[model samples]
Target: MTTNVLMTVPTGPGVGLTSVSVGLVRALEQQGLKASFFKPIAQPHPGDEGPDRSTAMVAQGSSLRPVEPIPLHEAERYLYNDNIDELMEEVVGRFQASVDNDSTIIVEGLAQIPGHPYATRLNKAIARTLDAGLVLVTAPNDMRVQDLEHHVEIAAGSYGGIKAHDVIGCILNKTIPGSLGAKSYGDQFARRPIFKRNFALLGQIPVAEELTYPRVKDVAEFLRARIINAGEMDTRRIQSYTLCARGVENVLEALRPGVLVFTPGDRTDVIMATAIAALNDIKIAALVLTGGYEPSAALIALCGKAMAKGLPILSVESNSWDTAIKMQSFNQEIPLDDKERILNVKEHIARCIDHDWINSFALNHEERKLSPPAFRYRLIEQARALNKRIVLPEGEEVRTIQAASICAERGIARCTLLGKEEEIRRIAQNNGIELNHGVEILDPDSIRERYVAPMVEIRKHKGLTDIVARELLQDQVVLGTMMLEQNHVDGLVSGAVHTTANTIRPALQLIKTSPDSSLVSSVFFMCLPDQVLVYGDCAINPDPSAEQLAEIAIQSADSARAFGIAPRVAMISYSTGGSGSGNDVEKVREATRIAQSRRPDLLIDGPLQYDAAIMEKVAQQKAPNSKVAGKATVFIFPDLNTGNTTYKAVQRSADVISIGPMLQGIRKPVNDLSRGALVDDIVYTIAITAIQAGSIGA
Candidate 1:
């Protein structure tokens, strides 16, 4: 299906919807997607034969050709006369004409205005009629969470009935940086149970001063002022306006770049001081003279010198107070000619919006479909939320170093690299990789003495002497494990340059399994094109008994749920529902029964072939009554050989990215990466490890 997105604001009126809409279209186009712009109904602009200001701005700012906007007067007339059917028919026809099979069509909706009590209903109808996914944009004001939830519910509702599925996501617009609205909701914005909303919480757009500032020309035009001395600075931006009613000395202190100085035309002292400030490289935006007065001949000549240096001077009939009040109430619209401001708007949007989610949505519009990028994004987001430290024992490896840099750059984890600081820096410099600020490097040899006694005291019962403990502590993995055991670090990730045994042996000896766990098992998060699947007992268990297999299934399901993937487990086998009886099939059947007996709340089904476990058609024919047959997210294998081989096969054949061999059942978090893992693989593994550490405390 072609990508069609309808952007509407919830309780708007300065919600910054126009800028966001244009920015989204531009962002999509920048990603090499052909995106078109359409405004079905637009506010009326004076003497404008073309599109509205926002629509025209998008056309001028990007390559997207503008479609004709339905005039506000015509739309209001149609609605007032109760001819909505005819209105919708014409609107749908116009939208279809603008749509292309290959290009994405971005439809802009009406802003919150008077006489539009049914704005939400009208927008929902338009989205439904256009078969477009609705994106609700809301700004941060005095709105509480309950108010936002009510607004979302209302936006999802239509005139006829509720259609929550019509809404794809919501955007918290113009949020203040570091405010509660920006940090509180966070990555859990969509998943919070209090909201009871299934739509994606795309992200928050912080208040950008550049986007909020109005251009000098726009302000002048809005106030109906006459330009006394015009130059090449008509496009200068005004961040704030100031009244020059005070003395010249007081006004001089308040003068700053982007400040539009407002004073009476007779205030020659203030006007001359401002002109002098402009000439001194203070860079004032413009000068607005009130009281319908113009500068005297000598004063005009003095102002003409500054105007020659590219400063605008305007004269208005209203006094300073009235002018200031009018300026405050003026609607801040990005002028079509202000290309720099428009570019700033687009860039701000590109940086703030959820790029991974939107890119995935553009490619595939299915709800709840976890695209690979979005899956990786969620992992990083969760890890950043935890902000836990993870030790990397294979720090000398190039991939480990690069992965640490990435994790640090993304704030995914605080990575402590176990290696000589100078040596790691040399390797990083030689490889042309810059370490991020969040990465810490330590020499394992330097920390050996402090951990020797602690290591010996723990393993003294197993005949480990101080000398032996000191020697073992020299190993990077051992030292990292000691750090975890002593609560110095939150988690550990190793094995990129070493074998899996080299990584797991130290954790098993020092960290040990949790009291609830019978044995430690491993699982891989297989990121498919459409979803993330968990493959369990893949690396740890060699030939697990039914009891151990059941434990692995339960652990895998719990791990899946912890990471935000719902746990619908399918105990995989060579047979479906006793179609063939064998030791392997019987083992899977027994494990399924045992797992169900232990955790009755889990959605688990067993003794099903691979096809019957995941393919809906095959599941219907083979295990029709099974609850988790066709939608299994966690796959528990009977043995390690079967699990490992199947996971690798799926990974290679389908070109899927598999993260982990994440060791479950551990008291603290310690994971082993594949020896040949890529940089991204290590990054995600560290993130997963950090998240596990957060769940279990330090």
Candidate 2:
């Protein structure tokens, strides 16, 4: 199911609606759900660039996939000619085709510009058509408290007559920093009678100067200037500009980083002083020559040398005063390739906005269906509900450090990296990864002695000696596993830089299997577009007898339910219901009977082909009388050959996201990663491990 949220600007433009929309989409994605963008009624194109700046911004800033925006002329023509019904139909159809069942679509409305007299009506109509909820975007101007309340009341009343189109909340965008001192605007608005009864005042966002500044490239493109000396300064951002009509001494005092200087091109003294400042490592964003004047060839050559040191010089036809005026009024649009600014904006929004209330509101009011994206999001949320300590043995690996940083930043878990503290810090610094997010790095050499005695006692029956224990504890994985055994950490995730055998052997030797489990098995959480499936015995247990197969099936079913997937067990084979008699088919049939007898509450069917077990149409033709033939969330394979091959095929060919080799039946939570895992792969693995620890206790 799709949750549709409509964002409308109640007041005029300059309220940062596009920035707020992009920020909200990112926040939703950070919460672990797939969030997409849609613009049913596109705004008029800005100059020659294109229509729908909001759509382009969202596409570049977030991980959501882009869909081509609907053109503005189509909706304008239909609305102008009084074809409202046809307009609504066309919009709804296009929106349905753009998004899938897994994503939550954030629909942006039109800007409150002139000639669009029916903009509010259009927003209300589209929200009603899509059965979406409404969120009003308002900015703080020179209006008083009563005037602000009146404007909000009118905006909320626009949706009063629509059925099921509720106004969920309002965001106060671009407010002054300390205007609402000692009390947030949300709390103040909550005390107001009109706003309290109508909709929730979500929170206020302070105006960020970084979002308002134009890059040097933006200024150059807007003024139609010629570059005298172009270098690596195109991406430099200009916070403000200065008109250098003063003396060279005055200009020298005013020169600073990110300041654009606009002066007559023939002012040799000013030009020489600027270049000298740039040579001394004082970087200027750019220099604009006004009045179409050019310096002498020798001076221009000298400026070219300065360009190599990172100074951009541009010449424009306007005079110095005119150039300053044009720069002041320049409309700053974030370029599609400016990733640094996009990241800055996202970080600012995450810190300033009240995402907890917004997320909780969405979860409570939206549809209660579990999509793959929503399932992953719920896992992170569940893991954060009770913070658990997770240890990473491959601490010096790049992917491990990056994943630990993300986990710590998002509060997914409290992570501990096992390595020398200095080496971990050096790796993080070299890779530009931040480790100040509360992630701890410990030196295993300093703590290995404390765990040697415990490890020897635990393994005394297996002929382990104190000297051997001390030597074995030198390995990071073994040390981490010993920590788990001693209750120092709740979970452990390793194997990014080590072999799977090396990672799992330590856990098997120390943690061992749970008391109720007969054998340990593994499952991959196959995340399809709409749902998450479970494929079991893919990473462990090569071939087993009927009894072991039955135990694997039971363990897989329990794991499926623990991770929020309803379990329906299917014992997959090459035949259905004794249609073909073979050793493999008989083994699956016996395992199915044993599993059913052991757990009568579970829905299970056996001896079925893969197609007959998963496809409803094939099940109707092959095994119509079976209960678990058509819809099975958990698939129990006959052997590792079938299980491993099928999951890998689905993961690579069908483009499904598989998250494990999550070892079940272990006494504690210790997950092994693939040798070629990405940073995100390691991150979610840690989250899953933390949740498992919460379920089974430390």
Report the number of the highest-TM-score candidate: 2
Backbone Cα, N, C clashes tallied per candidate: 0, 0
lDDT of 1 by residue, 1-698 (tens): 22356555554676777878887776665443456777888865445554587677676535456767777788878888999888899897777676666566778887777766766666766776777877777775756666666665565454222235566667777766555656664443455552344466676777766577787888888999998877644666777779999888888776777788999989989988888876765567889999999688888886777888777889999999999998767876555677677766776675577777656646443334343444565677789999999999888887899899988877899999988888888677634467967899988888889998899888988999998998888788999999999999999999887889999998899889999998999999997755788999899989999999999999999999887777999999998897989898999999999999999999999988898888999999999999989888999988888998999999999878799999999899999988788787898999999899988973
State the lDDT of candidate 2 residue by residue for 348-440, as single tens digits: 564455667546535444333345655676777788886999999888887898899989988999999998788887767544468975698
Error of 1 at 79 (Å): 29
Clashing pairs in 1: none
Q: Residue 75: error of model 1 in Å? A: 26
TM-score between model 1 and native:
0.55
State residue 681's C-alpha deviation in candidate 1, in Å. Answer: 1.2
Model 1: runs farther than 4 Å from truth? 1-4, 7-351, 354-369
Q: Rate the local accuracy (lDDT) of all candidates.
A: 0.79, 0.79
